[model samples]
Target: MRPPNTPPARAVSTPAADDTPAADDTEFRTLLDRLSDKATADYYNPFTTFDWPASIPTDELWMSPELLSCHGTELMDELSPAQLRTLSRWESVNFYSLNVHGIRELLIEVTRRVHTPGFELPSEFFHHFIGEENDHMWFFATFCLKYAGKIYPDRSVKLPEAPRDPDIENFLVFARILIFEQIVDHYNVQMAADRRLHPTVRHINRLHHQDESRHIAFGCRLVRLLWERLLDRGPDEAARHELRGHLGGYLGRYLTTSIESLYNPAVYRDAGLPDGFALRKRLLVHPARQAAHAKVLHKTTGFLQRIGVFDARH
Candidate 1:
C-alpha cells in the first residue's frame, strides 16, 4: 500500500554480523569480513602483473577450434568449408566482443556501488576490482582491435529488466550475473596457462584469472548472505512463493548461451550459407559448447546445489 521505495515496515533482518564464512548462510557477515581481509593481503600491482616487453604472435590462434564455430554446421550443417572458416573467425570476434562489453558493464555496476552510501565494505575491494577489470577490458579490446581490426557491438540480451517485485528482481540479477562470470572464468583460467599463446594473451588471462578468483569469492559470499536475508523476510506465503519462482526461473533460463546464435547468421549468408537459424540451433548444443558450459558452470552449479536452488545436475 505504501510507496514502492519505502523501506520494509519492519527492520530488515541481517546475517549474524560475525567474521566467518559458511555454505548454508550461517555466519555470513563474519565470512565477508574475512574475505575483505584476504583481498587486502593478496593485492597486486596490475601494471606489473604482465611484462609488456614481450612481443605477440599475430598468426597464432588465440582460441581453439572446438571453441570456434562450425560454419553453422552445429545447427545448419549445410555450409561450404569456406563458410565454416568465416564462421570460425566471426565466432572468435564474437567471443572477445562479449568479453569486452561484459567487462565494461561490470565496471559500471561496481563503480556505481563502489562509492555509494551503503556500499562501503564491499566497495573497498571493488576499488581493486574496478582497476583489475579496467586492465582486463583494455587487454580484451587490445586483442580485438589489434588482430580482429574492430570490436563488435554488444548483442541484445536484455537481462536487467525485471518484474515489479524488488526482492525478486534483486535475487534474479545476482543469480544471472554470477552464472555469467562463472562461465567466462573457465576460459580465462585455461588461456592463462596455455604456453602456446603469446605472452601478452597469456598474461591477460593470467591477470584476469587471478582477480576473478577473488571476485567469485566475493560474489558467492554476497549472494549467500542476500539469499538468506530474502528468505527470512516476514512475507506471506504468496510473496515467498513469488520470490522462489523468480529464483528458479533465473537458475534455469540464463545459465548458458546458445553459441549458434552468437555470430549473426547473416555472417553465414555473406559467406554463402543456406540458413542462419538452423545453423545456430545446431551449434547451440554442440559437444564443445556443452563442455564449455560444464566447465564454466561448475562453480555456479556447486553454489546452486549447495543452496538447494537446483537439483544437482552434475
Candidate 2:
C-alpha cells in the first residue's frame, strides 16, 4: 500500500473535453440516487436490531456444514459428530473475526476516497456505505467477543508490491473490496437460510446479506466504470493487454489468499485439533476444498470477467 500522504495518480474530476455526463455516467448517478434512497429507507440501528441471546448453544452447529472448510474432504468423515459441532463453533468465530478485519480495512480505503477528487459523484452514497459498514464491523465484533472471547487476529500476509499507477491502484482497491464482499456474501446467503443453524447465527447472516446486496451492486458498477475510464485513456493494445494480465494475476492471488485465510491454524487449535498447521495444509490441497473455493468465488470471478478486468482466456 502507498504511504498515507501519497496523492492520487489521476484526478477523476477531469472528464472528456466536453465535460458532460456520458450515458454510463448518467446510469451510474441514477444507481447512486436509488441506492442511497434505499439505504435511508432500510436503515436500522444495529445496536437495537438484534436480540442477542444470553448464550448460543455449543452443541448445535454454529456454521452450516456446506460452508465449512473441510466440507467435502475426507477430513469431515474422520471427525465425529460432536467434534464437527465443536469445530463449527471455532470456525464461526473465525468467520466473523474475518468480517471485522475486512470491514475495517474497507472502511479505511473508502473513507480515503469518499469526498476526494475522483469520488464526488458517489460521495453521497459513500456516507451510507461507511455508516452501514461501521455498523457491520461492530455487530460482527460484538458477536465474536461476546461468544468466543476473542476476535482472531488478522493473519493475512502482505501482498506483492502493487503497480505504481494511480488508476490501477484505485481500481484494485474497490475491486478487492467487491471480491471480499462477494465471497463473504456467498457464505452469508447460505448460513442465513440454513434452518439447522441457531436463530442468532441466521439472523446476523440475514441482515448482513440484506445490506451487502446493495454494496455489491454499487461495487460492481463502480469497478466497471473505473475500468472503462482506464480504457478511455487510450492505452495502446499492447498496454491494455498488459494491464489485463497484471490485474488477472493480482486478483487471482488475492482470491487464493482469501480462501486460505479461512483455514486458520488457530481455529483448529481452538476446536481441539492437533497439528493445526499440518491439517490446514492438507485441507487446502484437497480437490474437494479447491472445488468449494471455486464455488464460493464463482460469482466474483464471473463479474470480473464480464467487466474486462480479467481476460476471458483465463
Candidate 3:
C-alpha cells in the first residue's frame, strides 16, 4: 500500500543494563544445551525410523474421526465405521502431505538465512532446526508415499513475493514462520497425544511435535526480538500503516488459507465419495467445518490477538 523504501527511525533494542555477562551466558547455554541434547537423543533417520507397517489396518482408524473436515456433520455420521476408517486413512495422508509441503517452503527461507552473515549467535540452533525440519519432511512424505502412493500436490497459486522495507523484513519473515508453526502445532499436539490413531501415524506426529516444540519456542522469542528492534527504529507514517495492515491481512490469509488447504478432493474420492470436488467445495463453507477450523486456530488466534498482531476486528 505504501511506496517502497520508507526510511526508518534509529533502532532501539530491549534493555540490557542489569544483564551481566555471567547471567546472560548462563541463560544462553541452557537453551543451547536443551536443543543440542534433544537432537542427540530424539533424532531419527526417516529411512529407518519406523518399521513401516505392511499396510494401514482396515479395522483401526488411521486418524481420529473427529479431526476430519467433514467431522460432526451429517455427511460424516452417515458413513459406516468402515467407511470412516477409509476416510481416516485418506485424511491422515492429506494432513501429512500438507506438513511436507509447508516444511519445504519454510526450509528454503530458513536455509537462506542460516548460511548468511548476522546469524552467528543463533547459528548452532539453526543447524538443529534445519536438520529436524529435513527429517520431518522425510518422515511425513514417507507415510503418504507408503500408504497413499503419492503426496498431494499444493494447488494454491504462488503469489509474487511482497516487497518490504529492509528494516522490518526480518519481523515479517519471523512473524510468518511463527504463525505457520502455531497453526500446525494445533494438530501436532492433538494427534501426538491422540491414542486413537494408529501407532505409526501417532509416532510420526509425536516426533514432529517434539522437534517443533523447540522451533516454536525459538520462533516466539526471535519474533519478539525483531519486533522490538523494528519498533525502536521508529517507523514513518507510511511504514506504521503498512505494518498494521500487514499484521491484519497476513494473519487473516494465514488462518483462512491454512484451513482451506486441507480440503483436497482426492481425499474424498479415495473414500468412495462421489463428486469429490463438489463435496469439498460444499464442506469448505459448511458451518460445522468452519467451527472446527476455529477450534484448530483458537490458541494461535488468541496469541496473535494478545501481541497486537491481530486486532479485535480480526
Candidate 4:
C-alpha cells in the first residue's frame, strides 16, 4: 500500500513529440554521449578498490575538523582535543551514512524515469549514472559498517508530497539530485585532499569525487534543460512568477534540510556530548554555522541562480 500522505504516483505519459522538451538537441546529445564514454573508461571494481584497514585509530581525525558541525563555534573551545577527535570519528560515519541514504533515494527516482517517453534521449546515460551510484552506495555503506560497526539511521525528514505535474516532478527530481551531488562533492573534494586523514578515508573520498564530477556535470546540464522546458510552456506572467517562486521555495527548503541532516543528535550522543538535542538546535542557527552552510552551498546556489531556477536576490 502507498504510505499515508504520499502523493499518488502519476502515470507515465508518452507526450507528443512537440509537447515534450527538445532534449535531443545536438549539444545535450553530445554531452550524454561524452559522459557515457567517460563512465565506461572510468569504471572500477569497488569491492577491490581499497585496502580496508582492520581499524582506524580513534585518537586520529576521521573527518576534517573544519567540516564538523561545531567547527568555528564557541563549542569548539569547549571541547577538549580528545573530544574533538571523538566527534570527528562519529561525524565521519554520519557523513558516509548520509551519502548511502541520499544515493539510494536518487537511484529510485532515476530508475522510475529511465526509458520513459520524455526521458528516452537520456536513458543511455541514466544506465551509467545508476550503476555508478549503486557502486557509491556500496562503498559508503561498507566504510561505515566495517569501521564504525553501524551505519547511522537516516535522520532526514520526509519530504512533502510531490506535485502531480510530471514536468514539475521531473525537474524537481533532477534538481534535487544535482544539489545533493554538489553538496557532497564539496566535502569529497576537501577530505580527499586533506593529508591528515587516513589513506583509506582519503582514497574513498577521491574515488567518489572522481565519479561525482561526471555525474555533477550531467546533472547541471540536464537540470538546466528541464528548467528551459518548463519555461517554454509559456504560462502567463503571473503563472510564470508563481512557478518560479514555488520552485525556489521548494529547493531552498531542500537545501536547508540537507545541511541540517549533518547535525544528527545520535552522532553527538555517540561522541559523548551532553544534551545532544539542545546542541543540535543551537548549533544549527549559530552565526558561524550559518556562514559555513552558505560556503558549502555557494556553488550550488550560484548555478541555480545562473540558470534562473533561483532569483538573483535569493
Task: Provide the TM-score for each candidate, comma-separated.
Answer: 0.73, 0.95, 0.85, 0.93
Best model per TM-score: 2
Q: How does model 1 fare in lDDT?
A: 0.59
Tens digits of lDDT, candidate 1, 1-314 = 00011111211132345734234434544555666677678777665654564334434555544445552234335544444555555555666677787777666555644645434445566776677678777877876776667887765344334565555444554565566566667767776777755666677677677777877777777666557667778378687667666666656655643222354565555446668667656656777656655655677878876875666443
Candidate 2 on 1-314: residue-level lDDT in tens?
Answer: 11112234444445446989878878999999999999999999999998988889999999998888899998899999999999999999999999998888888878888778777888899999999999999999999999888999988866776778888788888888998899899999999999999999999999999999999999999988888888777569888878788878888888888888899999999999999999999999999998898899889889989878776654
Q: Cα miss at 260, model 4 (Å)?
A: 0.4
Top of the candidates by lDDT: 2
Q: What's the number of clashes in each of the models? A: 12, 0, 0, 0
Model 2: residues with Cα > 4 Å off, grouped in runs: 1-10, 13-19
lDDT of 3 by residue, 156-216 (tens): 4343344556546556566667777777777777787888878887888788888888888
lDDT: worst 10-residue window of model 4: 1-10
Q: lDDT order of candidates, best first?
A: 2, 4, 3, 1
Ranking by TM-score: 2, 4, 3, 1
lDDT of 2: 0.87
- TM-score computed on alpha carbons, candidate 1: 0.73
Mind giving the per-residue lDDT tens digits that candidate 4 earns over 1-314? 00112222232234456764443466787898999999999999998887888998998999999999999999999999999999999999999999998888888888887877667778899999999899999999999999999999866876676677878888888888998999999999999999999999999999999999999999998888788778868567777788888888888888988899999999999999999999999999999999999999999999999988799876
